[model samples]
Structure formats: structure tokens, C-alpha cells
Target: MAALQIRQDYSAPDLRQRAARERDTRASLRLLAIANALEGMPRAEAAGLAGIKCQALHDAIQRFNAEGPDGLHDRHRSGRPEQLSPGQQAALKAHILHGPEPERDGVSAWHLVDLCEYVERTYGDSEWGLSGPLKRLNLSRQKTRPSHSNGHPAAQAAFKKGAAVTAAEPRGTAS
Candidate 1:
């Protein structure tokens, strides 16, 4: 394979400064050492001391040479877009706090499906399906039912007592 030619723009001061205060300070220092050795010392020796392959060292050195400071930061990667805006999110939070409880709607409690449907229908927007609305809004069931049964002592006593006590049995024969 042909050896890659790279120019390192990192001056000694820059390498030292970056190496000193970074979160990954040691790694940065090692990278700087590799860069220094590549720029001043030797490629093989620098890459070996830095514990990295020559190709990786070459790439780092190239990046340092081109972008300067900002190259060290992670590149921006796009994420999923919002189903609703920040204002919508804040409004939804308010709705969760003091909006009419689900019980008022003849439902026992709020289920995931119910909440999703409510948001879609409330805004008169039919495009959003269950998942979109669900991701945008969250609701849970209310577990307010008492976990007990009442026992009636009067009924129990009535069942135990009767009016047949006056009718006594005949005495048994005795000597």
C-alpha cells in the first residue's frame, strides 16, 4: 500500500494546550505526541508510542492540519423531527395538569389510545395516527379504587341466632 502524505497544522504550543485541559487529556496528549513525532520525529516511532495504527494517526494528523480547532468536536448528526413544536409541548403539559380529567368523558381513566385519539381529534387534524400522538403526549390510568370489601356484622349475627331456644328437649330416663 502507498503511504498517505499528511500535513499537521498543530504547532507545539497548540498540542500542549489541547493535551492539558481536554476531558480525554491523556488520549489527546498521546495523539499530540504522535502528531509531533510525525511532524518532527518519525512516523513509525510516533504511531507506536501513541498506541495507534499509522493509518489512524495519519487521518488525525490530516484533520488537525485542515480544520484546526473545530475538527476535535463531534460532527452534527440529524435526529427525528418533532411531531409538535415547543409551544405545543408546553400547552400539552398544561393540559395534563388542569385539563378536564378523562373521567368526565365517560371513560374510567386515560389509556394511551384514548389520549392519542383525543389530541388528534381536538386539533381537528386527522393525519396523525396512534404512534405520532402517543409519542407527542403521554397519559396513564388512575388507580383510585379502594382495595377492600365491607363486612356486615348485623347480618352475620342474625344468621347465627334463632327463636327456637324455648322449645327444650325431654329429660332422659334416670335411676
Candidate 2:
């Protein structure tokens, strides 16, 4: 197969300058590879100098030919789509912020597992995990310590006061 030609009008020095100015490391490497190629360096040597494969240099050459220096930069990639719609996400966020109802949700506070189950039951999204969604909604996993239902606040305060008084009392010295 014939080697792909770099149609961009930049000289070896001009390409090096562009590489120097490029903020993206990958793009700069591509630029350097093209510059070395323009300077009559072997394809393997050029790619090695740029720390990329010969095939990568070939691809870069094709991109340079088609779209000039701008094409050397990586294109924006749209990753995996969200499982829930914007409205559903908003509803989930609101539900989290409002907190769980003890009588209805069967819990005093919202836990990650409970929230995951809630999403599965309410939103019919069994695959959804609460961790990432909660993070995106600015919700943290921290919860206040649980208090015992039968604990007496007054008695506890009295006990603390008695302990403090006993601790402060001085002992008699032995003669």
C-alpha cells in the first residue's frame, strides 16, 4: 500500500512550533511525528521519536491531510448514556433531599442499599446504583448517629453531673 501523504503546508520547523504551542500531549506527539516525517526521518524512527506506533503516525498523517493541525487533537466522545431521564433524576434528587419517611420507607434514614432498592421499585430501574447518582446530586453518604428509643436524656445528664462531681473531689493524704 502507498504511504499516505501529509497535505498540510507546514514545514518541519513550523510543525515543531505548532507542537510546542499545543496543550494536549497526544496532539503535540502527533505533530512531532509529522515534523520528523517531513524532515526525511524513517517512519519507524519518526514514530519512536514521538513515542507512538508507525500505524498511529499513519493515522495522524491522514487526519492532517483531511483537517490540518486541528484534526490532530482528540475528538469529544459521548460516553454511555444515563439509565434515567432528566425528570426521573430530578425526582430521585428531590426524594433524597426530602429524606425517607419512617412509616412509608420503613427506615429512619436513607442508606445506599435502601436508595438502590427504592430506585428499583419506584423507577423500575433495577440496574441503577445509588453511589454515582448520589454523587452527581451532591448527596454524601454521611448520616447522624442513631439514638436509642428508650434512652432517658434527663437521667443521662444527671449521671454525667454526678460523675464530674466525684472526679473533682479531693482525696485525703496519708500521714
Candidate 3:
């Protein structure tokens, strides 16, 4: 909407500096749109240039002309930008990989929380403020083998098949 045609007709962004800024921009745009209309520019041309359709532009112009300068706001620029940027998480993985180990001793397995804290500490300690988008690690802990364990992939597969299939058929159904 143009810079001036603001109203109390509908809900609006909060009435602080940001809201006031929105009003000014809207009021200014409203003025410009009306000026353009008055100068005989076509509605489509003016509206498109103002980043809205002619109908929207006309509506904005009407609202401003009737009211004052509070209507031009694009609300909710807060709260994590209010939308997701996909694959932003990749950057975090790269950063986490680059940072120092969280544990002084490299002997122990890493807990998930330890990794997270490590990320915060290592990067946050440095200048960049150390944040990146988050994602699950591609790898996971392999199931620990029992004390009497067989270390074969095929054995594992057979075990799974047996476990899965045994429940379905009773003890003597093969005949």
C-alpha cells in the first residue's frame, strides 16, 4: 500500500516504531499512487510498480485517502523471520565439523547435548557467534553387541528375519 492511507479498520502490526514506519511508508505510497492516478497513469502500471495489483493499489489509495497514514505495514518480521529457509542447516554441520572437540579426552562417545554445547561454546567463544541451522546427524550409534555376539551382517539379517517371521507362524506349521 502507498505511504499514507492507514486505517483502524482491521488488525495491524503493533503501534510502536515499526508500526509507525509501516504507516509512513504506506502513507507515502498512497500519496504516490493517487498522484500517479491523478496524472492519468494507468492503474495496472502504477500498481505493479508499487508491488501490488491495480485493485490492491486502488484499495490502498482509497483507504489512505479516507483515513490517514497507518496502513502500509507488512507485519510480523520478527520471530525467526517467520518462515523457514531450507538447507540452512547444512551450514551448521559444516561449522560444527570445523570447531574443536568438546571433550578434553577423545576417548568417550559423544552425547547429543554435549555436541550441542560444544557447538555453542566453540563458536560462540569465537567472533562469528557460532550458529547454524540444525539437523540430525547422518550417522547413529550401532546397536551394541551382546556379550555372546556374532559380528556378521548376514547373521544380523537372519536374526531380524527370524525375529520377524517367527511371530506369525506357530511352531509346527511347515508341514
List ranges where model 2 is wrong by over 4 Å.
145-175
**Model 2, span 136-155: residue lDDT tens:** 87888898777899999987
Backbone N/Cα/C clashes per model: 0, 0, 15
Q: Which lDDT tens digits does candidate 3 get at residues 1-175?
A: 5443434433322323233354366555555555455455677776665556676776766665565445443445555431223343455456445543536724244445555555455545222222222323353434245544557876677878446554566787895
lDDT of 1 at 146: 58
Query: Best by TM-score, which number?
Result: 2
lDDT of 1 by residue, 55-121 (tens): 6677666666676644644456887666667776667657655545646654555555665666676
The C-alpha lDDT values of all candidates are 0.59, 0.88, 0.49
TM-scores of the candidates in the order shown = 0.46, 0.75, 0.30
Q: Tell me which of candidates 1 and 3 scores higher on TM-score.
A: 1
For every candidate in turn, the CA RMSD to the true structure comes to: 12.6, 5.4, 13.7
For residue 77, give model 2's deviation from the true position in Å. 3.9
lDDT winner between candidates 2 and 3: 2
